[model samples]
Target: MVRNHSEDRTESIILPDGKIDLFLFLDDGVNFEIFIGGICNKPIVKHPFPKSVMFAISFYPMAAEYVFKRSFSDFLNKKIILPPGYMGFYREDMQNFEGFYRKACVTMQRIVTDPIDTRKVKLFDLINRSKGETKVEAIASEIGWSSREINRYFRKWLGITLKTYIDIIKFCNSLKQVKSGHFYPELSYADQSHFIRTVKKFSGTRPTVLGKNENDRFIQLTTLSDD
Candidate 1:
């Protein structure tokens, strides 16, 4: 959940984190909008209205594909507005975050009428468990799926290559360290240069600049919690 308590609009930098998000934007307890944000390869600058609240649910690729049965390929780096009452969600759900979350869970369970592939589950689990540091071929071999098929499924459902997705995962996992002023590579990155390049590629800035944040402009860094 994100809320802007100030009287003026705020700018936020949203970095890629390999998750699709559904957002409910409520303005001053009156008007509202629903939108879905897809996986982005780079940072996005968002301007939210002042004195508004945003309720959001983040979904992994598997959930988006199996549970929601929706393809986000067309929404890369973009957000699409969802109609009112879409998927049984209504303005009334915005009364509070906890109630909204409970209702969303129930709705998701009801939407899953078909069995999800176990292999796909293992594939995603491995990537997350490894913090996207493992080799793609190794993940495919362990999951009993071919690399080609895995990549195809990723592109079809998530709108990106498997390799790119893994990189995003690695970058996301490194954020905590980066936020603490550790600019050096802590994951599977080869060296400082490689790490810097990846950080710049996704964030459009070097590690030092990102860590400084400079007025708490980076939403991910500002809101990150230790896990």
Candidate 2:
């Protein structure tokens, strides 16, 4: 979860990070609104409330299906208002950060009692293990499914093409290296030019600018701490 105390802002670009987010907006320490965010294939410009507190839960790709109990394609590149009672007991503790987190975990644990899709789980593991360089055909072969079938599953569950998801994973890995002040040429891209282009495509900024961005720091910190 992430808590942001906004002062004043007009618009900002939200870069793709290959995950779904659920946001709970609090205004004057009261529950104001709730939204469910989906996978973003490209950078998006958003205008948020100038002065408000925001708490967001960034769900991993594999956990989204269990948490929402729906296909991600329904919310691709969009934010939908959560239905009333969807948060269960968590709604009562929205004002307390720690209490809210505990309640959220309980809600998730209860909902995720159902079995997960093993093929999708394995596909995510394959991408992470290969650092997003795994071949699509290889995944299909291992999962005993045709490439077309695998692509369909990816589109429905991830809200993006398989290739785009791979690119996002690769970009995230490369970003970690960049933030740590170490770029290994052989591990990430074909060349420095390729790296710059890929970063700009997803993040709408050059590597240097991205490295210095506070939003990027928040995303990295929250993502790492989530586990």
Candidate 3:
């Protein structure tokens, strides 16, 4: 029998973006995403547990070494992103996940073109190296993309800025730990407060309030902001 225990599910959906992500796989940092297409049903990215179940057709492991110095957006939103821009190609069909992951992979790979940039190829490896310590300058320098271009690629791919995406990753990880009774809690409930504040600041809710509580559902943070 398979013993089951809940752990952090590495995933997030950014508000107003056409991407939903399944983070932390294929490598420690790089994961997958399903693009939101009004005309296309993209793939559903998958994580380990309580996650939407989907079969992943693995891209060739050798594909991981591909590096890219340019951004993914040269063709992405411009409607020029080729299907082979990213993955090495595998077709996964899963009725359970409604084909979310497969469609996303196909869509992402659609952006590929000849002479793939070695810098962009490194994005996958960089994600693995990030480990919560990645800095904007470093990311910008490594792939030879400017900070602005990198932000555009991140915004296009992950549906959020790199820093924001990282925050969401950290928050969701801590959340999983808390739910599984593995989180370190301060006697003063400092974790809860910080979690709530951070969520409220970014997600516009208390941390424990999301997903599990209907009331936790909230309007986007920008609507509540003082800008």
Candidate 4:
């Protein structure tokens, strides 16, 4: 179930999963995510947080955007005081949670970590799409700007350069097909090796840990963080 209200907060329920939920802040690029790890359910008092969030259960690689966008990190770092409900991602907005508890929590997590506004998705989408095509500079030119300007803009908002984003996208594109049985009947060993190498050069980890979907995979909150 998906719902968007006048408040610009958008949320929905995807197929149930034990460990994850992706929530998007609609009309805004800001994403709030909630990750359910382990079984710790003890209520946490609202507190500040500061630190890049770990991408998932596995820690083979780390992302600055993943951890830094978290407002919880700010709270933890004493950057600000959060109301009781806004401590960690899990602790925020529990009272108003009408349903989909897990998903709701995930949304809250994204709330803390939203890096760019909603409109920025287009830029990312384009960059991701470019993975299957030509050089980054050429892609930039086709998109309207010189490679330098594009890279500069991307870095200003994404914290990583456009080159890194492209790497992440291309890597994920290759890994996704492989992981989804795309290779079951067709991909050659050479094909697999190339994909792994490409992904490793950018992510320092392969599909197992840093696969594209491994982050906030749902359309609502999916993003390709820098390598």
Candidate 5:
């Protein structure tokens, strides 16, 4: 959840964080628009109109597939507009963030009736537990699943390979350290150069510039908390 309170229009560079997001945009707190931000491997620049309030919910890979009941392959690197009342949400729910959050929770719970695959559940648990530092082969061994099968599932559901998804997770983990002015590699990168290169590959900027984050241009950096 996030909102832009600035009276003047502002630009924000959003870095990939390996999650699909559903965004609700209220221009001048009256007109409404909704967009789904698909998983991407690069940075995206956004310009929100003044007095616009934005709310978004990030979905896990498994929940995204089951709740939405569709493949996200076509949504990669794209922001697709959703039709009105796409998910049982209406103008009344958008009146307040609190109501919207409750409504969204109920909608998601009501829709997700299918049983989840245990292997995929374990796969995600291992990835989260390792913070994306574990190799695919190691994860496969730990979860008792084949590396080929894992990659096949990733490609089929998320439109990316296992290695790419792992890289994105690693990059996201580095964001907190970078936000606190720690530019050196700390998340199992080969070295400082490898860390910088990976950050640039995903964020389109070097570590120093991202650390400086002039004018709070990077949305994720500005929102991070040192907890």
Candidate 6:
């Protein structure tokens, strides 16, 4: 959860790691709104209300299929407002973040009752095990599939090609290092220049600027916590 303390300001959402998010926004006037957000490959800006509280659940790339019963590509780079009565089944106090999280977990457990997709599970496991360093060809070879076939599966289920997903995972891993004050040269990128350029591309700001922003810190916290 996040609470903004200043005047309404535009926040840049950097989701270099692919995800689908569910958000609940509670403004100062005590009105609540909920939205389902899809995969984002680039930075997006939104103005949030002052003193607003937001609770969000970031879903794994593969979980979208089980949770929503739709192809992940269908909601790519999109946000859809849920119906007004969507939260009626839960009776938790909205002000309690932990309570809200418990309610969300219960709801998700009920919705995700379908059998697991073993292929997708193995793919996700392989990518994570390699720490985003494995090449697409290597992954495909290990999985006994052609590169083209692997890419097709990724696009059909995750709304992005395999290469893009790998890039996002690498970028997010490097971002965590940057946030931890371990911005050493030759650590993740080729050099300092390459690091700065990649960070700017994914976050819409250079490393220095991103590190100094309070809102960005919160964003990083949320991203890291999801992992």
Candidate 5's residue-wise lDDT over 121-193, tens digit each?
A: 9888887778889899998998898999989888888889889998999999999989889999998999999
Comparing 2 and 5 on TM-score, the stronger one: 5
In model 2, state the lDDT of residue 57.
81
Instruction: Give the per-residue lDDT digits (tens) of candidate 1, residues 1-227.
Output: 98888876557789999999888988887888998999999999997677889998898989888766778888899998989888878888888889999999898888888887999889999999999899989998898999999999988997899999999999999999999999999998999999999999988899999999986888889899967
Name the candidate, 1 or 2, with the larger TM-score value. Answer: 1
What lDDT does each candidate get?
A: 0.90, 0.73, 0.39, 0.37, 0.86, 0.72
Model 2, residue 109: distance off in Å is: 1.7
Candidate 1 ranges with C-alpha deviation above 4 Å? none
lDDT digits (tens) for residues 95-190 of candidate 6: 788888787788888888889977778887888776676788888878777889878887887678898887677777776666666665434467
In model 5, where is the ten-residue run with the lowest total lDDT? Answer: 1-10
The C-alpha TM-scores of every prediction are 0.96, 0.83, 0.40, 0.39, 0.95, 0.84
Q: Which candidate is the best by lDDT?
A: 1
lDDT tens digits by residue: candidate 3, 101-128: 5565575566444566566668546754
Ranking by TM-score: 1, 5, 6, 2, 3, 4
lDDT of 4 by residue, 95-187 (tens): 234433565447446645546443344455565455433467666656566778766655453344556555544544554454453532132
What is candidate 4's TM-score against the reference?
A: 0.39
The clash tally of candidate 6 reads 0
Query: Over all chains combined, what TM-score does candidate 6 have?
Result: 0.84
Misplaced by over 4 Å in model 3 are 1-115, 155-159, 182-195, 201-204, 209-227
What are the per-model C-alpha RMSD values against the true structure?
1.2, 3.1, 12.5, 13.8, 1.3, 3.0
Q: Please count the clashing residue pairs in each candidate, in the order shown.
A: 0, 0, 31, 22, 0, 0
* lDDT at residue 69 of model 4 (Cα atoms): 41
Off by over 4 Å in 2: 4-6, 48-51, 89-91, 181-186, 214-227
lDDT-better candidate, 2 vs 5: 5
Best-first order by lDDT: 1, 5, 2, 6, 3, 4
